[model samples]
Target: MFIRTENPQTFIKFYPVTVAILVLQIAIWTIYLLPLPSVQMWSNLMTGFNLGIAKGEWWRFLTPIFIHASFSHLLFNSFSLFLFAPALERMLGKVRFFLIYIGSGLVGNIGTYLIMPLEYMHVGSSGAIFGLFGVYVYMVLFRTDLIDRANSQILLTILVISLLMTLINQQVNMIAHIFGLFGGLAFAPLLLNKKSDGF
Candidate 1:
C-alpha cells in the first residue's frame, strides 16, 4: 500500500527530505526552462567552477548539485533520487540523511575541483546520488535487516553499473562519483547505527 498511493501527504510524511529536494530541483529547472536569455546565467552562478572557488566564491562547492546542464541529466538524477532517497532517508533518519548527503556531495565536488581543469565547469546531482548509493551500500553491510536480500543485490548491481559507466564515459567526472561513494562509506561508520541505539 505504501509503494502505490495517490496521497501526497503519505509521501511527505515518510520522505520529507527527499520530497523537499525533489521540489527544489523542479523549481530550479522551471527557472532553467524559462524563455528569458538570462536563464543561462543560473548555471554560471550555481556551477562548480574551480576558478570561482579559487577566487573565494566557495559556495560553488555545494551549489553545483542543483544545476543540471541538460534535461537528460536532470531526468536521470530525479529518477535516481525518487527511487532511492526515500528508503535511505528512512534508513538513516532525517539528521544523518542530511549530513551524509551534503557531506558526500562536498567531498565529490572537492575531489573534482582538485583534479579538474580550472576553467572546466561541472553541474548536476550525480555526486549526491552517488552518495546515496554509497550510504545504501554501508547499510547493506551493517544494517542488513533494514534491507532484504533482493534490495541488497539490486544496490550492489547499481553500484557496479555506475562504476563501469563512469570508467567508460570520458565526459563523466569519475572523481566526483568515486569520491562521493568513498565519502559516504567513511561517514557510515560514524553516523550509521551500529545497534538499535538510535541513529
Candidate 2:
C-alpha cells in the first residue's frame, strides 16, 4: 500500500529555517573562535547557560545546541544539518520538523544534566542529528514503503557509524545522543501515522 504523501512546498518550506539556524550557529561559533573581545564575550555568554536548569536558568535547554567547542565541531554539525535537515523538513513539514529538532535537543540536554556532573559541560547539534536518525529508523520500520530496504540499510549503517564515532570521541555527549534517539523514536511513529487507519 502506498503511503500517500504531499510534496513539500519548495519556495515556502522548512529548509530555509533549518539552513538559517545552522548558518547562525556556525557564524556565532566562528566569531567566538576569533580573537575579538566582542565575539569572545558573546561566545562565553553560553557558559552562563551551561547548567542552566540546575541553576534555575531554564533557557539553557535551547541555547546549548547553538554553542560548539571548536571550528571543526561546528563545521561537522553544520554539514550534517545541511545534509539531513532538508529531507526531514520535506517529510515532516516546517513546524513538525522544528518541534522534533528543538524537543529532541532539549530532552537530550536534560538527560545530560541529570546523568553527568555539572562541571562537564555539554553542547552541540549531535543530539538533534541523532533525533533525525531515530525518525528515519522509525519510518523505515513502521512505514516501510516510505523508504526502501536499501535506503533503510544504508541509514542504519550510518547511524551505527555515528554512534561509534561519538563513543570514540570522549568529549561528545553520548548520553544526550541516546536520549534524543529514544525521544525521536517515541514521537515519530505517533506523528507520522496519525492520519492512517492502521494501528
Candidate 3:
C-alpha cells in the first residue's frame, strides 16, 4: 500500500542545491581528514585561533563552519542544514538566507572565542543550523493564521528536542547553539524591516 502525502515538491526542489553544497563540504573535509601532506596542509587552514579575525585571517570565522571533527559529526550537521535551509531560503530569498547562515556562524565563532580558552579548537555547522531554527521560530511567531499555530508547535518541538539532545550528548556545543539563536533573533528584525533604524 502507498501512503499519499501532502505536497512533497518543496522537499524535492530543495534537495539538489542543499545536497550538492553539503556533499562538497563533506568531500573537502574527508580529504582533509586523510593523512596525506596535502590534506593536512588544507586542514590546517581551518584551525580556530591559528587563523582568526584578530590575526587578520577573517575567513577562519566562516571556514570553521565547513570543517568537522568526524564523519558522523559532518553527516549530522550537513543533514540538518540540508533539511531546514531550503525552506528558509525560499522565504527569505537567497541573499537573506546566505546572510543569516554566515552571520550566525560568525556569531557562534565569536561566542566560542569569548567563552572558551584561546587554545580550544572547535568546528561544525550546528551553529548555523540553530540559527535557521531561530529564524523559523521568529517567522512563525509573527504569523496570524492556523499555519502560525502549527509552526509555533513545531518551534516548541524543536526546542524540546534541542534540549534533550544537548543533555544526552556532552559533545554538542550547546553554547554555540544558544549564541546562534540569539544572533539570528537580533538580526532578523533588522534584515526583515524596510525602515532604516540608526545604529
Question: Which of the numbered candidates is closest to the native, going by highest lDDT?
Answer: 1
Separate clash counts for every candidate? 0, 0, 0
User: TM-score winner among the candidates?
Assistant: 1
List model 3 lDDT by residue over 96-183, tens digit each: 7778887887898888777876566777888877877777666566533213565567666877798689668878777678888778
Instruction: Report lDDT (Cα) of residue 106, candidate 3.
Output: 82
Candidate 2, superposed: residue stretches over 4 Å from native: 1-14, 34-38, 47-51, 193-199
* Candidate 3 or 1, higher TM-score: 1
Task: Kindly report which residue pairs in candidate 1 clash with one another.
Answer: none
lDDT of each residue in 16-125, candidate 2, tens digit only: 66867787797777667678898766665564244556768677677777878877888888878776777777677777888888788877887887888776676787
* C-alpha TM-score for every candidate: 0.89, 0.84, 0.80
Off by over 4 Å in 3: 1-20, 50-56, 144-147, 193-199
RMSD of each: 2.7, 4.8, 5.6
Give, for candidate 1, the lowest lDDT window spanning 10 residues.
Answer: 1-10
What is the lDDT, from 0 to 100, of the residue 99 in candidate 1? Answer: 88
Error of 3 at 187 (Å): 1.9
Order candidates by TM-score, high to low. 1, 2, 3
Q: Model 2 — TM-score against the truth? A: 0.84
lDDT of 3: 0.69
Report how far residue 35 has shifted in candidate 1, in Å: 3.6
lDDT of 1 at 33: 83
